[model samples]
Target: MSTDLIFSDATKLAELIRTRAVSPVEVVQAHLDRIGAVNPKLNAIVTVAEGALEAARAAEAAVMAGVALGPLHGVPFSAKDSIDTAGVPTQRGSPIFKGRIPDTDATSVARLKGAGAILLAKTNLPEFSYSTETDNLLTGRANNPWNYDRTPGGSSGGESAAIAAGMSPLGLGTDLAISIRGPAANTGIIGLKATHGRVPMTGIWPRVPRRNWHVGPMARSVRDVAVAYSLLAGADGADGFSTTPLRFDTGVGSSPDQPLRVGWLVEPGFGLIDSEVAATVQKAAEALHGVGCVVEPVRIPALEQENALDIFWRLHRMEVKPAFAAVTAGHEDEMFTISKAMLGEPDTALVDFVRLEQAAERLRDGFAEYFQRYDALLCPVLPIPAHAHGLAEFVINGRTVPATHSLSATVPLNVTGLPGLSIRFGTSRDGLPIGVQLVSRWFAESTILYLASLLETASPVRDLHPDI
Candidate 1:
């Protein structure tokens, strides 16, 4: 029962708890035991919340009293280290912020707790949550559960790994570029990147530029993602940029009556993608087509321009670099290699920064125009599957590219402030998981969710899990 509990999705776990099939204390303890068994090798969970069992006991009492329960009542969830969890240490995968404990929970974390979800632990990530891989001087690398020699994808790698290994049924991860979806793809789980600002950035570390930063849910099933997203969406007053209201009908959207116009691209007018990944994306498109989606091959001319990656890099380097410079000045040696490089770079001139911002706006406009013709765009989440640990480069379509280009297909969505969701579709030749992202216009998460539902149902890879 404990092993079965570890592999269950949050929604199912919630139901079991609500029906008195499992006590909250039992659910929490099952996950704690799973974490203790698997976390040493994966290093996915950086810090376990101090009073998880105590919280679970209170939840069980509420259940026994026949009190009305929230949707996630007693379902255990993990949070990316960047998210504050009151008593838990949110080290942000860095020594600079070591032992940092916030008195208040992040808006998303608070909302999840309000929904009766138990916060079990904090997951690891790259230092300052800045890198594409989940390895830091503070917490060791979060290895892929499927293949320990490979990366899980970052900076949400820890959260993804935890979900994959059954350490937590659901978790929260932030995506500036591909942090959420990339790791999900690598780890064979579901990750949603809500439209920027839809989920508040309050109580999260190093608040990047508002238009690119987004918080979303990660879980094993689409329904779990939907359940968590409903609670996570909505603006918190602390984040001025999160003023947009979230409007999504999971029940209706999950089973849309009308056929959807889903535009999919394998190359995506950017970096090279492995043949296996390209094929899996095609399979996803076909699965959507089989489920009444009018899948078509399409390209976004604006994304073909070389400036997409440049625009993303420039904005991040210009804004996030300065924000962390003060803390990193004398502590360069303590920071991760990527963090040092990011902070050490010279600042961009005002004119150059403005030009980059304008370019990004144009890119966003292009996606807006494309979305008018299609309900959502489906593309490979990452150009390649999980790669070797400590890898600095990858071979894509016979060409060597810097590993950072993995963000090419994903960062554009962040630039456009659009929503995207990655769902596992197939497996690589090496048996690594292959997933694709369904991207939608800003605030059109429901459309993507609808398309993802179709793919999730049709894909044979849904029940596949890594053996520890």
Candidate 2:
């Protein structure tokens, strides 16, 4: 095995495989070995495709026989347990469907395979993906590889942990609200939640109800993300919300640090921020200032005046609840207690839904106004880095935090369907990785990613693998 492949990006791996310097089977084997070694410790992947290697061997033979390869070519990646893969357990982290397997790979999964990326395993997620920690009755818990005592952060926690610990270079993750961003922030890896309808949501679970969800890439670098996003973006006729993919003129524009405008919101948008989270965000603001961007204290004008969590609940109430309701029918007692506590709560009171819709408009308008003056907004991904495992409550700075939506600073962006990127910015005094999210205008991920790339260059935090 080449020492280079251990942590190499997809771009590098593709080129190596293209040149025949690397075999697809070898590349897949390395990821398989990494999963075998790390999954036992972190529990990131719930189901492994045992025959994945043999498939990779076949792929290698095709490459050797002078066949054209897909963009992903020989790379290995994982899908969240929620995505269907033919002949593989597609358990969404619950015991109800223990032996369940689909007859077809998800549209995204099939497309990726058609393009040549190998499906290595299915990473874990919260049961029915209701909580912020990735623990389910079936797959158990996924720990932060950086600090096992802390959570890797939910729903997409397993995806983030797997990438951070080098179990795989790339993986698929779905973000309804903060699933992708929060876990990436929690585990100190790169995660992006695409603009609403940017990626098709055909084969994913729960999309049959909630239409606001998006699927995107989680990986080590911005370029890796670009490749995944390109492959995943475009209308599939199945996802009606997706606009037909058309030519976007702009590439990733640079000049990372010039005397341009940047917004820094240290306050949790509609929640509270702890000292550590505040400090981490402050440090990022200062770093942006040092890099020549004018950082200013910006406010989310409608945050206090709006109930975004209520909006979140409403969007899910009519669309998502039925699917979740089915899950809670028999196993309500066995489910995460918090999920039961939060589920089936009334989302809107007719008048309240009207008011919340107005509020969403105001919030969107506020960001629209702010973006006219600033390039991007910076905030903490979560009020605190992945809270202590499964505690019913969180205490931040001598204040007892409310359970579900208390840590919700990132949900507003989801409502506006903007682009948010999480990068490893700071760690706690105890060494838990804390991340600051940079949000850009809708469809302008390049701006946020450019800022993140600059941060990566100035203070690189890479290759921090788990001891597991």
Candidate 3:
């Protein structure tokens, strides 16, 4: 069935294309034939969108003319070539924006193509998205559909290796640190970031640290990041940090009925983790304390100083290195040697960016006074999991460090705009995967999608997969 409809899930391919049993041009030619059979061993979809199957054959001729569809109507996603998609080619994997095309779209891809989804491809990142791992020089290294020699984590590593190898069920990454919850916890899927301005960042791009810029969704189910976070949350008055007003719920009282109060954190006391990634994030806080929550272990002394990776490298060398000094002035030999060594370093003053924005407003007022007595916080999205490909050091557990200190647990939720996520609860003993995140507070992404749908129903790597 179109190769099992490339591992279904965008709420079951938008309920089989809203009951026509399927046919938005057979789900965009079964994800363009699962991106031409696994995107040549996981380079993870670099472009592929020229009129995506004629917009899935005009969304299967508007479902045989009955029209009225939307809620990912024809379902098929994928973004993160630094978003924007008007006429497709968002080459942010940069060769100085090689064939860069963008006339519009990217208010979360124009609200997931106005909720009926179907963008069909763009993925790949790291250049200008500025590395977590995915390569660049213009569309290269993405790998890790379980372990293509590791790493699928990056500046949204090709939208988490094209939604963990099914090519694309949903996507849209972009995070400032550990981009999209560390490649959706190194490709086991389900990422979210959601709260620094709850969505809108208009047409995106090297748009400076719009307060730790965000833009979320990346799925493999949490009901497709709750139907792409209810059409990518509110406020589109051009992202003045997306002016609040988002209130998401995702039905079933968004999960937590009570007895909650969760909060785990194995050694956030300065990096180097991985005792099997702190026992799989303490078995996802013992699977949310076997379903009634109240999980313990707290901590948070402003993320155990050692200047949490020097306050995200002094907010990326004083505000994301001056938005690439005018887009790499005179093309600096077509950029990306780590974006010409982060725009030929040296700059940080203005009183050291006002003492690193007053130590990032005291770690965002100490995680808003530790989420006022915790209701959500579990941790470890990356302190070592999918390492290897070109890494400049990062062993963990047996020490080793220095990979720009693996953004010390996702740059304190991009310096406390909070709302982290991640999910995928376990694997690793060389089986890869292993996630955790959660976080919350500050537009509580529906309480971290109701404790990640209760640790994805006590996860056992819920529905496993990766045999691409």
Candidate 4:
């Protein structure tokens, strides 16, 4: 097959299939071929859906026979191992979940299948979906396609790596912090932590207590993320927050052309950001200006909370003990040291959970009030570009940054339960990808996507691809 097949986006592939220009079997086969050639280098995909070949052929026959097609017709995609796929092993990067296969598909899986998209493979993640690097004992670490010595930031690293390498056009990734956005930054792809509660989280693993978790999209293009998010949005009765009637629409994930009020911040919140990181934020803001977005540096007084980050991590740590006790007990040696450290922390106390909840609420309310005056907030996704793995700690902005857990600038948004995005800005001096974040109000996914689509067309990160 011609290499051109690998460049097709989920939307474009669907359109081509709809027009009968390419059969579903052809697309799926091409992706499988790509995976066969590329996955050894990236170690991104853990399991290839055994019978996708037959499934694609069946979809082709139905399309030819005049059957109605779903919006994602013939698109190829992958999911983080945390998402359940019937009869497929979802190890979730841990020995505990090793050899485990789900009897039924998760809501998102069913939705994608119902839309005629082929499940290409299951991507890797951190053990129990913990940590910021996508590696575990079972699938190993997912290396950055750009630089093998570096990591593809986790826990959604495999998904972003797959899309960045063109192995898959789209993917499903769950997020609480930068699990979606951070990998996109490192891999030079695009990811959306869709507004919490906008997309159904019915089937993701470790099922973190409903504080501020989200299951969202990752793709090479912003438009692909939008398409996936739109197809997956609904209030499934199985989910607690899915209380309202199932409402599925575009969910405003696409862009609006009105002049956008963008607040750009590079204060690093709690961690010390890289010196060049702030300059990149400014440059990205300037790029947005050329596209008609009004950019200004804004102060977020809420971020100044002393010990804010420690408290947040403590809360997240507290929740993880229950979620990972079994896995840690069975495979403690296999888990990342940082993740192990989190577990070693005291269990979440009731008062601590309640206090963290209140603090998170305050932060959200303050950020929301501020966003009411701005179209979106722009900032660095990480303090530095894909750094050496297993550092245990590092410095940023020439400051003595102590904690290994404070690198993520995108984590606060997770605490706020808002929609966040990470799009490539440019590359670092060492040739790794650099990126910034775009955050919008809750459930304002379409607006964020629209802005991303506009920025993509204007500046275009499409040319930056890994050597793999």
Against the true structure, what is each candidate's TM-score? 0.97, 0.92, 0.36, 0.93
For residues 1-468, write the lDDT of model 2, one tens digit per residue: 634675888888888888999998888888877777768889998888877898888888888998888888888888899888988889887777778898988777887888899888899899876678889778799998988888988788899898888888888887877888889988888888876777788888776764557788999877788788778877888888777472441223545554557889876465778798798888888888888777888886767767777677676565666777876688776766546656747655778767777878888888888888787888888888777787778788888876565337778877888778888887777777788888887777667767887776655355554555
- Write model 3 residue lDDT over 178-259, tens digit each, in one string: 7998888888888988878878878887665677878889888897897788788889887777876666532122246657
Candidate with the greatest TM-score versus the true structure? 1
Structure candidate 4, residue pairs in collision: 132-154, 252-446, 252-447, 253-445, 253-446, 254-446, 254-450, 255-450
Candidate 4: Cα lDDT at 421: 88
Against the true structure, candidate 4 reaches a TM-score of 0.93
Local accuracy by lDDT, each model: 0.88, 0.79, 0.81, 0.79
CA lDDT for candidate 1? 0.88
Q: After superposition, how far is residue 447 of candidate 1 from its true place, in Å?
A: 1.2
Clashes of each: 0, 1, 1, 8
Scanning candidate 1 in windows of ten residues, the lowest lDDT window is: 248-257
Q: Of the pair 2 and 3, which is ahead by lDDT?
A: 3
Candidate 4: stretches off by over 4 Å: 244-258, 268-270, 306-308, 326-339, 348-353, 400-407
